[model samples]
Target chain A: MEKWRATSNLRRSLKSILNRQLSSVSEFRYLNEKRSCQSSFNLIRDCKSLGQVNAIQHRCFSSASTLVQRNPSFSTLNSDDISYFKGLLGEKSVIQDEDRLETVNTDWMHKYKGSSKLLLLPRSTEEVAQILRYCNSRCLAVVPQGGNTGLVGGSVPVFDEVIVNVSSMKNIISFDKVSGILVCEAGCILENLISFLDNQGFIMPLDLGAKGSCQIGGNVSTNAGGLRLVRYGSLHENVLGLEAVLANGDVLDMLGTLRKDNTGYDLKHLFIGSEGSLGIVTKVSILTPPKLSSVNIAFLACNDYSSCQKLLMEAKRKLGEILSAFEFLDTEAMNLVLHQFDGVRNPLPASMHNFYILIETTGSDESYNRYLY
Target chain B: MEKWRATSNLRRSLKSILNRQLSSVSEFRYLNEKRSCQSSFNLIRDCKSLGQVNAIQHRCFSSASTLVQRNPSFSTLNSDDISYFKGLLGEKSVIQDEDRLETVNTDWMHKYKGSSKLLLLPRSTEEVAQILRYCNSRCLAVVPQGGNTGLVGGSVPVFDEVIVNVSSMKNIISFDKVSGILVCEAGCILENLISFLDNQGFIMPLDLGAKGSCQIGGNVSTNAGGLRLVRYGSLHENVLGLEAVLANGDVLDMLGTLRKDNTGYDLKHLFIGSEGSLGIVTKVSILTPPKLSSVNIAFLACNDYSSCQKLLMEAKRKLGEILSAFEFLDTEAMNLVLHQFDGVRNPLPASMHNFYILIETTGSDESYNRYLY
Candidate 1:
């Protein structure tokens, strides 16, 4: 236990140091004027510091309230509705506390705020279905929340909509090592799955900066193109099966672990990337690739966009299957990261290049990857 | 010109030699009782020799005629329909020849045969759209054919239905070397695309025995999981974008080559693996991996299924990313292959094993791959 604790502490420290060095080099966002689209909504968006998000949100979205008016069709949440939810899913599962409401009612950037009075935490798909059924009959508007790390105001409640967070539904159902397929509940955090797979000699096909908080269900819902996308494709590719719940409380069990199913329409993909508007994803069956022993990251500087493109082509041609990621950021984004975030020492501090590229490669042989580099 | 011809000749000769040596070891089929399921329907299936298919199919499916009854809601082909098709897509495009119809009507296994009297070859998506519009208006049942290499009689028409073959639509559209994205008409033969990508320093993610004859459209429509599925994933992963013509002649243009796009429903996946039931895939934009220089195949003898599973798990772990294919067949299947195919030689001729396992590895570093082996 002592040895495990020491190793865990060392690994965490290493990860923190690594994040400081490379978190700024997340997936490219083409220099957004407002905030560089800091940390994507998907599972694998480039990592952004929470401090940076806070700093920007405070200055922006002062007129967030004027964006949209509340719909009259949505019935007001009353004491009776709250009582019904508490009866269905225990009183503790239903939240009316302002402090907790404040956290769930707001977006990751704290830009989009809502006046939602209730938040429901369902531990199972059945509970979620029951809650939805009640809400549907009452004509109450509801919003499904995951990790709440989205930048585009997707996770936040727009008005007085009740928030249904799946954080309580986290559990790994089954794992097939022969096939490297994992079945996990919706609320399982991305980092948790990654670590679990890491111990099992496998790795999740997706990864991102928000992995520490982002749920796998949220990743599937948003169809996140994460850090591993340059190599592993997308959620549409890695997700083998999905179990989602429709607004009317129907559990759309499209979940099948088979990789070679062509029996009928692959309806599971419809819920993927639909952002929980179609259904709240309850479970996910994803194809995880085996973890490679050797991984290397190369930091490169390019003079221009054309040079970056050229370099990308060369890297693809040379790196082949081992290439896991090819992420880039402009000099302006780099300057912002350095100025806003503390302890993010620039890799290329001597002279600022027009563009910066971060390339990652993973393989079985440490020596071979090093030699190729 | 002479030097180029010599190089081409050498490549052809080498490929033929390689195919002859490895074609028998395509994929695992668990000692298929009737015919070993010869090859898969999708883009990636175990490649079976033409001789093996003919030998088994001649004996099997003797009662295939009585399987599916034609729906009475469909109209029979008439002279007016023929004239209309000829007017829209030339006289040569409308094929009534028994010789050609006989070939297209029969599946690769020769098990299921259709009685379609007319076969229409459309040159473009527009032409296909027009043909479908006319057919829909007339209530004529039409079956789309691509390569006619699908197992289980999918490509074959039933009960005098119009056969719309997309062979004439074969055309390479655009290829982004940096992105390694290839956009091509569905009728482009799988072998042709493989060769094209080979020249462009890339490779199609899917491969099967029928690659020489199978069309990309058919591959996408059936969602073929070919030899490389163990490494590159299914058509769901590699197919970045798709264009399909719905049953009512409406064009579903869901084609977008961008790796990350989460705007709305990813409807393209519904078309994939739907087996042309939903729509006919006209064009495909697929993600091709960069061509690796070194490829090695290992043939092993296993005593039991348990051992095979163990080996597969080990290969996934030890071999990691380089492991492309892991196919196995029992001694009975091997005996059938040896008895059926004339020129094929057994890799393990000294003594019979309970099972034979074949693994393929691809990598950029030749020496590294060799060392790992």
Candidate 2:
């Protein structure tokens, strides 16, 4: 009875945590306020004139409390530069299309916008290398973009720099069923990789809300720690190795698919979470876990914050491997969710609780999972 | 009943794997031969002449097929250098004692030995920085020594380099129980940290045969992937951050306990497995998993290596989180363990199995673990 009560409290905390996370689609994560931190991408898209776009960008940057000025040192993109890129990447890959550039120039949140004039899509690593080489010698600043789904202003160029997108390089290089290792090109979408692994009776070690559009390269570059981090750990744990390209066009082939990292100086980790600053991750090798058979979820409530913390600790220690995720949200966030979305009802309407938690457990046996739940 | 039979197969394989690991203490891991690949450390200890030492070193290098010659540019330790170190550190920290040098010069395997002239024990990171800074200016190469328990020849000096041991700097800086993060100095013994975490109701992410003698610094330096790697992960995964000192006396404070790694360039990983070439790790911030309540072990047998691999994949996927470890050994290794150890008796005496396997599972409920087993 005591264990059951503790578990109930744990479930409540999870719901609360999850609620907070959902509301965190705004700029900051886990903001305590009940209000939805809305994304301004729609607002940016609604703007008509170029002057209006600048006004919106200026206002958003000002509201964010950080203003970045464009460096005067960077070279402007010229016809000669375009010719070199077009010759190397072919005419079709050299994207001067205004519509595409406008879309790619803005961030996912629509808060940050860049004034980049040209976008280059490279199908092969060799082509990406040549593009970077030419850009480097000419002192042309480049933004190594992957999917352009980044919430941060990292992917988009701040000025008239050229954008290098690796979306065309998307390819599943290899997959080892026994080891559950997947080696893929930088541009592979997270959703595609997830689907491919699902077919193989394995799952990617990570799953996030942005899986639909986020590229595997962007995920690696940011070292994405998603919902499954509690179960599978971060990219640091799952990623075996990766290949990256330097500004000088040096392809650092640190990609090794070994589970055991006994090799000297794990250089790939330097690229992971670097957000393409150190180098642009070209290819990735990651270790995926096998997909389990059954999953069970529960929603419960806790009295206080301390109880929530205790419940999580108990779940981590006691539940061990079966505990996949434990998320919680405070009363305000839960109330906001109930009020904001129509047709959505509260799971626990019995009483006004301080916190709500959701606990999810997974196992191989369906019957066992249910019984355990 | 079919599940029981499969589990039975898993246990036998575990026994076989454990057998193979037991013999691996000598040298090469998973060597299928019945004969022991003995360590020559005791033999080196008995050597009376420097000529014999040279012959042993030469033979070992030649047999390994990798000969590393000493660089002539590195200056030998002199009295002035000794005086400088003594002034920088206290008199007792600076050691020219031949007896002490002999012990720190050889690895745990005794397969590799170094001829280091001086052993300097620094009490703090600052002292370590100064020592390196002086050594850098003088072009006096130095070997950073930890617990001196490394199986590979990474801990010892190749030639007459200065030995910088961090034994005196052992300290548990801080531990956050909520996060299960331990921040400790480089020289703290692995076993000691394990004990500390065990008292706090948590466990280290890794465990190995050399835990008693190995230092956490050396483990991080080599990126130690130990027995619990199947359950947890490597140091690359568990070690959240670290503090390192470069040869030019530049102290890089990358030590952070935050589980979220959104920061730029995880530079600590570069030092993790660089074997002290890039820099020497001074402090570590590692995430430790919570200690579970129940543990179950099974010894089973299988016919072939392919079956063992299949069983492991099933255990990893199906059993999921509860499956802590899956180890196996071939018949030859089993025979060797039984033949070598007098008191050791085979649990599966009924039949001569081709492969033996061991499966371990842990959970919160004792009843649940037994039921699952």
Candidate 3:
């Protein structure tokens, strides 16, 4: 609980800082056009320090509304609806407390916030279906949330929509070792799935910075492409099938373990990247690759972008399939990372070049990969 | 023309024979229940020989209607529409010749055949847009076709929908050698693009058996997954952007060259595997990987299925990154391949095993990969 409070406070502070910075930049642009260069210089010299800017910026925008207006098409939460939800989900599953609701209403970036009065935690697909059906009938808008770690502001609501959180629905249905197919509930955390696959001598095809908080269902829903996409491809190719509940509470089950099935229109692809607009993804069936034995990482510096590009081509030509990742960062980006994070040193000399490239190779022959490098 | 005729004849004969075999099996099932065991044996004995089966089967199903019924909602070809098409695209572009229309109406597998009277070949994206806009206003159903190599009957029209073929639009717009981003018209043949990339020291991320005939548009539209998918991944990840024409003839240009863009909802994904339903893909921007220097293919035999599964896990463990392809075939499949093609002998001794696995590894160092194998 204490950790959660700290995280919440950090997120709010970051959001406030960013909001203030954006407003200040816009005001500066407006003022610069009316004032002369000398006057602008004087204004900058007279302004308060960086710490004071936050307070002043906050005061300037506090009188104006920042919250998104609730959609009139959606019904506001009432006592009867809350009672019905509690009766169906039990009082413990229904969250109405203001403090608890704050976390569910805000996104990870703390950029988008909603005033949703109710947050329902359904433990099963059937319960999700029931909730959606009732919400549909009552003309209530709903935001189907997984871990709510989405960067695109997709997981949160724009208004006071009912939040149907699926964190309690985490479950690993089944796994076929021979086929490397994993069937799991939508709310299963990515890192947990990765750990489970690791035990089975396999690995999830995707790796992301938010793996700890992101859920498999949300990954599939958003068609999240990450670090391993260059090697394992996107979710559309790795996901064998999935089960989703439509707007009217109709369950569209296209889940199958077959690697190749050309039955019909492949309706599953529609819901894969729909981001919960078309349906609420209940479960996912994915293909995990076998875990490799040998892995190596190398960091190199390049004098220019062209040299980096040439190096990538050379790596592809020489390394072929063993080259797992070839990520590059500009000098400015590297400096920012070094400045922001403590105890993180550059693999290459800081004065070496303007760009740094990180290459990872995984193969059965560690000696061969090392020799090639 | 001669090769085309021979290929067309072979495809039709194969389809006819398969259709007859299906009907015969159904009839045999019904007759076996009513007839005595001896009679059933005698009937089998009295049937035509293996060589004669093809001829007999062809005659059995030839008279049946093999064409799909035309959709009532789509208007049939009229003189005015043909005249307008000919006026916009020259008369030579409007293919009304019976011999040519036969190939356009039929799919590669000869499984589906449409009865459209005209086929319009557009040479440019603007031409395609104009044709679709005219067709939309006229309420004429249009089937946007590429190489017509799709097995799912997606490239071919189901009924008399006007076939607006894009084979004439094959053009490589531009390719940035540094970025490895290739911008080309949708009609470019897969093999042509492969050859072009090979010259630039790059390779298409996807490969298929129909590389010689399949077009980039068809491959992207169907989201074709082939052998190289185990290494390079599907089109969704490789296709950076695309230009499509909507049902209303609105040109939706999302052809971006950036590797990372989080501007808005990625609308290009909707058209990636849509099978040309939502829109007609006119152009594509794809990221091509650099060609590798070393490649090795090995064939190994395993005594049992368990051994084969274990070998796969071991390969993944041992050859962590260099493992490009791991394919297995049973003895029956091997025998069939051997029997179907002359001079194609099994890599391993025939007496060795019942299951064969093909392993391909690629890396920068040929010696290292060879030593590891």
Residue B103 Cα positional deviation in candidate 2, in Å, after optimal superposition:
0.8
Runs off by more than 4 Å, candidate 2: A1-69, A370-373, B1-69, B349-352
Error of 3 at B292 (Å): 1.3
True-vs-predicted CA distance for residue A76, candidate 2, Å: 2.5
Give one digit per residue, the lDDT tens place, for model 1 in A12-99. Answer: 3323322321222221222232222111112112111222233344536444344234544457889999889988889899999999
> How displaced is residue B54 in candidate 3, in Å?
23
TM-score of chain A of each: 0.82, 0.82, 0.81
Kindly indicate the candidate among 1 and 3 with the higher TM-score: 1
TM-score, B chain, candidate 3? 0.80
Q: Point to the candidate with the largest lDDT.
A: 1
Tell me the tens digit of each residue's lDDT in model 3 across A247-276: 556566667787755332344664676567
- The DockQ values of the predictions, listed in order, are 0.32, 0.26, 0.15
Query: lDDT by residue for model 3 over B1-373, one digit each (tens)?
Result: 3433332333233233223222322232232233322121112211211112223346465622332223233456688999999999999999999999899889888965767788999998788888877876776777778999987566665556678888998999999987789999999999999999999988898888999989998888788887776566567668888887654455667788866443323556656765675567899999888776678999999989999998987776666566778888998999899999999998776585789999987665676768777
User: Per-residue lDDT tens digits of candidate 2, residues B1-373?
Assistant: 3433332333233223223322222222112233321211111111112223334446545443133444444567788999999999989999989999999888778876788889999989999999988987776777788988877666876667788898888899999887799999999999999999999999999898889978898889888877888888778888988887766566767787877656434657766876665567889999998988888999989988888889888778766878888888899999899999999887986688899999999777677778766
What is the C-alpha local distance difference test score of candidate 3?
A: 0.70
lDDT for residue B11 in candidate 3, whole number 0-100: 29
**Backbone steric clashes in candidate 1, count:** 6
Expressed as tens digits, the lDDT of each residue in A90-206 for candidate 2 is 999999999999998898888767788999999988888888767767767778889787766667766666788989989999999888999999999999999999999999988
Give TM per candidate: 0.82, 0.81, 0.77
